[model samples]
Target chain A: MNIGILLKEGPYNHQASDTAYKFAEAAIKKGHTIDAVFFYNDGVNNSTGNMEPPQDDRHIGNRWVGLCQKNNVKMMVCIAAAKRRGINDDVLIDCGEITGLGNLTDIAIRNDRLVTFGD
Target chain B: MEEFDDDEIVKKIMHVMRNAPHGTIYTYEGLEMILIMAAYDQDISVAFVDDGVYALKKGQDTAGIEVKGFAKTFLALDGYDVEKLYVDQVSLEERGLTEDDLVVDVEVISSAEIGKMMTEQDVVIQH
Candidate 1:
């Protein structure tokens, strides 16, 4: 199955991003192809390159980057939502790219399932 | 935006609003996303459940609260060709609201019917 994920909350403050990451990892392990992970609302915070978490805690942003890299999945952040929360190309993680909602529409159309993880 | 190919599939995308307006940015930003996707010519629908039904309540005034009220935006959705709107009947009655109190005309149906409809959708986005 080809699945797309929509994450709508930030890291640490909410479990949304963590759940989305874990879901993606599990999906890939189950032999399903992850189409993309599209970030909207506070979800864009998951793509920030400036996050510096403690040594013991999970690094949410880097986790997403690593997952996308290992699995060849696209990570997208809504440009409108990203700008509203101060997320831009300069601050974006290497695996994530800022895009318009049209990409989300395409993801919905192209994937077998478009799952949302949010508040 | 580029035109969709004739052979392209038109997915049924439903945006479920479960939060009240103004208390959070979910409903407002969700509306913004709906407007953008509307132009893509997909099969789109909006469902108002729980506190989401309050987003369409008539006579909303955000003047004193300083937040720009977008209750009227629901009415403008028709202009974008997003005409399929559903309101949960139980949610409406629970909140002491009726179809007459909403800013737009929506199909007031039971949550079960909406749940069945949701199962048929290719994508369901809730805010």
Candidate 2:
């Protein structure tokens, strides 16, 4: 199975992020394939690289990054949302480079299920 | 050119609505089955909108119910190559939410644009 996990919200705001990751992990465990992890809208924060959860808490961003790395999943962040939130692979700020809808189109063309997590 | 199934050619966009407590889940679940079948057999697209967006919410706590992980099953859609996920901008705003509130990166479009997208598609399934 090939899966596309779309993350729109941040780590703490909703269960979408965790839910998507859980799906991804379970799919891989079950020998499924993950096509891409597209991060659009607030979902871009998944790759902000500046998220800091307490030491005892789960570092969702890191976990996601690690999961993608382990599974060789294509992790895509919405350029627009990333820029709006100042999220980048290396840091987070008030403003940064933006992602475009075209990127989403590209992913849509290749993957099977474009699962979204938002509220 | 190769022939296509008329029923399969129609692009069906399934909007997953898990927020509503009652009959909504069944509605969305039915839509999910349809989308999965369409995408698995043909080409179909789905968008998760509004509070319905959380239907794909991660870390789903379905402890009380015996329902299989609907969100988890979503990750398997790629096997069918159905990969279009869109969210409504107005819905998010109306709920005092921004992209940051969702779990995945989804295409955020306005109501007008959503309507337009719907028209272009062969089918639109909202739960």
Candidate 3:
């Protein structure tokens, strides 16, 4: 199955990012394809590469990048939503690509399921 | 509210509105999404709850704020064939508003009714 995950909350403040990551990992382990992980609203903050949490904490941003690299999944941040939150290409993670709503529509149409994780 | 069967071919996509407009981009962008989905002709429904009920209040003057006022866009949603706007009755009453205060016509139903409708959707996108 091809799944499109929409993460609509920011990191740390909510468990949405953690939940999305676990779900994606589990789906990939089950041999399901994660067609795309689209970030909207505050969720676009996950694309920021400059996050500096405590050394003991998990590098949430890098985790998303690693997931995309390992699974060859598209990590998309809604350009409009990102812009509103001051997240741009300069700050986006290595695997993150800024996209539009049309791409989300395509993901929803092409994928067998569209699951969203939000606060 | 339209009913669907177990074998229905139509995809039910519900756009959830949970925040106030202008203060944050969620409601505005959610509306943008619904507009695009309107062209897709999918079965779409929007539920306004919590602080989201403020998006439909009448006589919103944003001249001081300088942002583009989009409350009027709710009035045009019907033209896009994106009807089925559900407003939570508890949210409205708690906010001291009634159907007459909203800019557009919406079915003010209980949260229980809306919750049941949510479980029936193929996809629920919250903003």
Candidate 4:
């Protein structure tokens, strides 16, 4: 199964990012392929590289970056949304890419499952 | 165009509406998404839960709010082959609304049923 995830909230304020990450982890563990994780709305914040959580706390952004590195899953943040939120390419996580809504449309069309987590 | 069949390549896509109609674009854009996906020739259905039931209220006059009234736009969905509409029974009752108060026709179902149906779908997009 190929799964596409849509995350609509940022990292700390909501559980959306955590849930999406866990869901993707479980899916990959089950031998399913994750086509992409498309971030929209405030979700674009997940791609920012400037986040600095407490030293012992779980690093949400790094977790996503590692997921992309290990599983080869695409982490895409909406370019327009990112720009509006002041998340430019210079601040994007290393493994993530800033894309457009057209990529989201393609993700919807190609994936076997498209699940969304939001507020 | 792609082909879809109930027993074959049919994709069960459910658009879950969890936001209100006004104050934000989630509901409006979600409707647009459903309308677009409806034309894709796939098996499509809509579920209304949380504040989403408010989107179907009978007398929504957004004229005062300056936002274009899209409540009536939902009524036109049936013509585009997007007629499968379901609302969460708990959500409706919690909001002090009944089936008769809605502008369009919808099957008032339980959240359990909607949850089970969601697990079975090939795609579940929540807005």
Pick the winner on DockQ between candidates 2 and 3.
3
The deviation in Å at residue B62 for candidate 4 is 4.5
TM-scores of the candidates, chain A only: 0.98, 0.85, 0.98, 0.97
Model 2 misplacement above 4 A: A89-99, B1-127
Write the residue-wise lDDT of candidate 2 on A1-119 in tens digits. Answer: 56666666677887878988988889889998887776655667777667788899888878776876677876776554566566664673222224554444444434555666665
Question: Where in model 1 is the C-alpha error above 4 Å?
Answer: B1-6
User: By TM-score, how accurate is candidate 1?
Assistant: 0.96
Question: How do all models score by TM-score?
Answer: 0.96, 0.50, 0.86, 0.73
Give candidate 3's total backbone clashes.
Answer: 0
Highest TM-score: which candidate?
1
Provide the TM-score of the second chain in candidate 4: 0.92
Which residue runs does candidate 4 get wrong by more than 4 Å? A26-30, A54-56, A79-91, A98-112, B1-9, B22-26, B62-69, B76-80, B89-100, B105-120
Candidate achieving the largest lDDT: 1
Q: How many backbone clashes does candidate 2 have?
A: 37
**Which is the better candidate, 2 or 4, if ranked by TM-score?**
4
User: By the DockQ metric, which is better: model 1 or model 3?
Assistant: 1
| Order of quality (DockQ) | 1, 3, 4, 2
Sort by TM-score, best first: what order?
1, 3, 4, 2
